[model samples]
Target: MASVVLTACQEEEGAEEGETPEVSVVVSLAIFDDFARQLGGDRVDVPTLVPGGADPHTYEPGPSRVAELTKADLVIMNGLGLEAGLEDVIEENTPSSTPIVELAEGLPVIDGNPHLWLDVQNAIAYVEHIHDALVEIDPAGAEAYRANTDRYLAELQALDEEVAAAIDSIPSERRKLVTFHDAFPYLALRYGLEVVSVVVASPGKEPSAKDVANLVDAIVEEDVPAVFKEPQLNARILELAADDAGVEVCTLYSGTLDKKVDTYVKLMRFNAKELARCLG
Candidate 1:
């Protein structure tokens, strides 16, 4: 009976030793968390700083979030001035040795539009970066990360084609996007659309009366039919402005995802579909 109990205990210890350790990751936003999930699979445990539909621009990471960042083995951020509020927290909390992956690091980033994930091609590049960083942090899951990234990249490629075709259907003249901020320049430049006007240059900054008047004039001059607003932005002013200008108000996702359009691929597809419906 003593031998039998010892053997069972040994077997249990062996089983525990064979199980993989969970990799702790802290992502700036839910979108990065989604990418981490796709690449990390069961090997990683990711906690996001910004919740769903939360704007990374204006998000203030609390002490609890900073503590979480300090404990993470890997920290992934959108970069490009998107995480304005968490910059100091990331710098202070995250150790120098911790692998910090900026999804927009290698891409040709625009000044104001940190919504790089909105463009499918850009998202492919981000996935590659995320995959490499994950493999570096946890070599044991390298094969898994590579396989998952390959599959996810294929899906993103298909999404790219779909977005291209959808945008092609919209007439060039009708492709002008007027929005709350210059957040869609990458998307517009990628798909041959043009941004006509911006209510504000930076996130959380309301346009002055002069600026709004100028935008109103530009919208009238360009015959822009719609003014796009993100879910997190103050749409009341935009609605009143659009109403005053006789244009439609449409909502677009920037830096964050809605529950229905969660993944990067789905978000891009949704943007294209919405643009087609509103602008085309």
Candidate 2:
């Protein structure tokens, strides 16, 4: 009878060992979640803290999201002050045993601009980071992660070359960028362009009359041709300021993904195409 009981217990343990627990990933934004999905393949499930079209700088995760973070196997974040509002929640909810990966690790980060994925090279670095983190979390999926990262890295290299060609079409003198926020420094740096001035210093902060006036003077001084507004933010103020400064207003994606440019590759291409159209 004792032998029979031991045999039944061993059978139950064998069944449990064969079961695969679902791997959970909590990403700070949609783009990172998308990247995670690409690398994780079908082996992992990712939940985004910031919804599509939501600004990462000001996004606040709700109770449901907090619970998701607590149970996640891995937590991915942009990690350059982009998710300022949800940092507390991410820290508090995530278990110490769970691995937290900052996708922007090893990328050249600017002091104030957290939009690292705007530059294709930075995005490539992010993919590498994601790949390594996923492999560490699920060693069984290491080969898949490496293969996916290599494929994605090739695409990013192609994108880098495409963006370079697009920016090369613009005259060096016409390569000035004026935006609603100081978000595109990495993009400008990567493409050999210049950021003349930004309307606001921080996210969600509106430009004052005096601030607008100062930007107008700088724009006139720099002879900037276009002012770029982020698609996720209200552009009325930027439009009015651009009119005052005698510059055209164009749209750029900052922290959020838009419907048209849903993927990271598409987002960079869209920005390049728009910049070429406006500045070329």
Candidate 3:
């Protein structure tokens, strides 16, 4: 959902400042890490503090994570409220000199939703922020970063068009979305789907029996063809609701990723594919 960046740097143990030392960029989510990798190329191998298949909303890094945070040369995060937990820890423990860049900060939001990257345009914005940050932190790699970002940004623009066309293939009436959580509002807005309801309004809040029943009722009433669940969250709640409503449960990539969906473009492509298959 969000991330914080930290950097660990030295002149390669024996090298001097003029040498091109590999950047140690640390970000909070797998998505941001991928962006850094794409832009940084061989110059950086960024580590994602929150591993894949973990929900950033409720994840709390362990004690040893502080060492990494302290040593980071640049730390990037999706500010706003996505990584509030990590933000608190960074404030208390990380050194004041640790350079911090938030990818989602200052971007437009819908009702303050932090999942802005769900929209391809917003994802592009995050990539742009990352591109700028990398250029700032490692002036030596500015040309590489610029070139990589140009190619990556162009690919994302094409992806945006592809996703739009995919969504447009679904019948208008079947475009309603009932997701496992509130992560899809931005995605829904972008692709013309309406978020009819969510099983859990927030992460870590399991739906009670009554809540599930209510969601089932809403699903039945909405008559959406399918309900979606994120890969990293519990699908049982959505499965139960969908079963009772006689609808299919499909997968959507949201806050986190798995081995199969290891990159941002793949994540978005997976989402559009699942949506079209289930609802088209």
lDDT of 3 at 18: 36
lDDT of 3 by residue, 166-255 (tens): 999999999998988888888888889999898887788878999899899989888889998888887887897899999988889898
Off by over 4 Å in 3: 1-21
Between prediction 1 and prediction 2, which has the larger TM-score?
1
Q: Any runs in candidate 1 off by more than 4 Å, and if so which?
A: 1-21
Provide the overall lDDT of each model, using Cα atoms, as 2-decimal numbers: 0.84, 0.86, 0.85
Per model, state how many residue pairs clash.
Answer: 0, 0, 14
Sliding window of 10 residues with minimal summed lDDT for model 2: 13-22
RMSD to true structure for each model, in Å: 4.1, 5.0, 7.6
Name the weakest run of 10 consecutive residues (lDDT summed) in model 1: 13-22
TM-score against truth, every candidate? 0.91, 0.90, 0.90
Candidate order, TM-score descending: 1, 2, 3
